[model samples]
Target: MAIDDAISFKKLEVFLAFMKLNNMARVSELLGVSTVSVHRSLHSLEEAMRCPLFKREGRSLIPLQAAYTFAEFAQRAVEECEHGILKVRETAGFNAKRLKIGSLYSLTLRCIPQLMIGLKLRKPVLDIDLTLGSNRDLLQQLADGKLDAIVIGVHTKSEFHDALDPELLSIPLFDDDIFLAAPLNSPYSGQTQINLTDLHQEKFVTLADGFVTSQDFWYCFEKAGFSPNISMRVQDIFSLINLVSGGIGYSLLPGRVAKFSSQIELIPLESNYGAQQRITLLLPKIRERDPNLLALTAECRMYGRHDGKKDGFL
Candidate 1:
């Protein structure tokens, strides 16, 4: 007598046929002639309500009042079942795959680009997204899960060493010795090598804040007993090297990047000038065994040299 008394649409169809024909044999013949099946459908309809829907009268089955109520909404229940299936299919297609990596602006220009190309050549389907940031910023992003990894300077006593996990891995990629880059033909270039103390009065064009090299540059100068004569601050190494080529102001840079200009003299500092800096590939110790990272680390090692042959800077 309520909405819960609804019956299946298939059962409702059998009741409709019985009502229209008034004879089980005639209903079965009109609906494909299975008299036994027609009887079973009516039996199930009665059991569902704990009451008989029809009784034999002169050999013809008759429908009860409950049958009329049950048939009224059977079609709506079938429609609701169909709609629920469509909603689930709509939600299954939205997630896409991609990997995000972060790196210093310096490496992004050269090292990372080369390595990514190599990686692409080998694995073209890998979806890679590279983010450029200052070394410190990239390191922070890596810790926060915004990046999978980063490439930057490695220092044993650096603030990061304390923060990295126990298995923190470091690979000596190349020697990134800080050099005094001066105009190639400048009077200062003729010297076989320069001592850090002698350059105390030289003008310095330093990297703007947030760079790992900027920190190391100042640290080295202080170690040599002089404060840098910072004449200007620049955001990118390529631009800074171009400025150096014009002889605007001398700057400090890693040996590999010093290759930016054939006109710039890269003067390797003497020991008293400062400690030698090691350019390392840093990653979680756990990833050390990952073939892809390991392979790329090897790629770095392959291109990592600054042959004194280029300009005899050493």
Candidate 2:
């Protein structure tokens, strides 16, 4: 009612259509409103704009120049709004049809398989489409809406960082230690926990740059005060452990990976090892309410993990 108040877009829309049709009765029918209501909106819009939109012309409504000018701009604005609504609906439909999930390549080798098997038996209806990448790339994909969730390793103090934003949720599911992986017959094999001094002269097979697990490995060395001599650098966890099996070099890695092969042995660090490696389930912080993501997060927590040295590899 006040001149300073914002003009209602709905009123402007009704006015624009009335100006085009020049017949209140026809506009009312087309717009699914009573003629009286259409006339009220147009009159209100004209008053709001502080200008006359239509002039009385012998038995017919004649649009003023201002009304014609406003119609062109209003049509484009309404069209854009309608397009946005359509795009949002299409995006929603795609999300409902597929669960775009990502996992760290390291986890994709083992932990994710267990998750998939566990998830399918519980949710056959979930049309899972998995992407394998680094945790950084996976998180970026989640923020961009290309992925609904990610499963990745959580290093110490790494879980609560920017990776898990307020708009995203995460829960620790399992942990693996940065075990001192060595050949089954190595001199350090019989030792339950390998001391920092034991590795001082050993060769190391480590992950390449940009891997999260790599952070735990190198930082542990830094904590121990000496970087192990590098013998080989690989991008995948499975390969690094395999090279260890071949006696190529010794390396530090999560214990769960060692389960996939029997040729290698894991020596727990004299310091806490499992305390360094943790696995977490992550998903975007969306408000639209997704029952599927919530259920998947629950499944991750339910799958149990083996405690360190449980298989006599102490």
Question: Which candidate has the top score in TM-score?
Answer: 2
The C-alpha lDDT values of all candidates are 0.67, 0.73
TM-score of candidate 2 against the unseen true structure: 0.66
Clashes of 2: 1
- Per-prediction TM-score, please? 0.59, 0.66
lDDT of predicted model 1: 0.67
Number of backbone-clashing residue pairs for each candidate, in the order shown? 0, 1
Candidate 1 lDDT by residue in tens digits, 1-314: 56335456676677777776778889898888599988888888777767777776875666777666655554456566666554543232111134466776665546677767866665566577888877778777766657655667654345645655555566555445677788878878778677777767778788888786787787778778778788889987887888888878888777767545687888777766643445556666655555555655666566565322232124
* Candidate 2 global lDDT: 0.73
Superposed by TM-score, candidate 2 places the C-alpha of residue 273 at a distance from the truth, in angstroms, of 7.6
lDDT of 1 at 251: 80
